[model samples]
Target: MNNVMGIALSGMRVAQQGVQVAAHNVANLATPDAQRLQLKRSAVEQGGVQASVTPAGVDAAAQLGDLLAAKAEVVAFAANATVIRRQDQMLGSLLDREA
Candidate 1:
């Protein structure tokens, strides 16, 4: 149960970082020689994922895709949050019954 929460929290954090990087790329679309950013993610050994920002090439189509992906990441973030909330509720109910 606790592990589930940790996994969900990590997922939410990754999604958030993804959105931030996407936003940065989209925001710099019009600037000259703006360094596009990309979010790289890797699974953690314990349980969860880690994200890092990296430089990327500038492409209009790719930037648009990133915006779309950012929208999806927002949804993913919300889903992870829901999982955490549900887990908390379940734990509370279990404790209540035990008490």
Candidate 2:
């Protein structure tokens, strides 16, 4: 149960980082020599995931793709949040039953 919560939280964090990277890339699209940013994600050894920001190409097409990917990440973040909310509700119900 706790593991599930941890995983969901990590997922949300990764999605957030992805969005931030995408936004940075899109925001600097018109700036000359502005290095694009990318999010590098990896699974944690114990559980969950991690993300890092890295430099990428300044292609307009790739930046658009990043925006689309950011949209997907928003959906992923919402789904993870839903999981956490449901888990909390279930735990509350369990406690209510015990009482």
Best TM-score among the predictions, by candidate number: 1
Which pairs of residues have clashing backbones in candidate 2? none
- Candidate 1, residues 57-92: lDDT per residue as tens digits? 656588679889899999999999999999999999
TM-score of each: 0.93, 0.92
Lowest-scoring 10 consecutive residues by lDDT in candidate 1? 56-65
Off by over 4 Å in 1: none
Segments of candidate 2 deviating more than 4 angstroms:
58-60
Please report how far candidate 1 places residue 83 from its true position, in Å: 0.7
Clashes of each: 0, 0
lDDT of all predictions: 0.90, 0.90
Pairs clashing within candidate 1: none
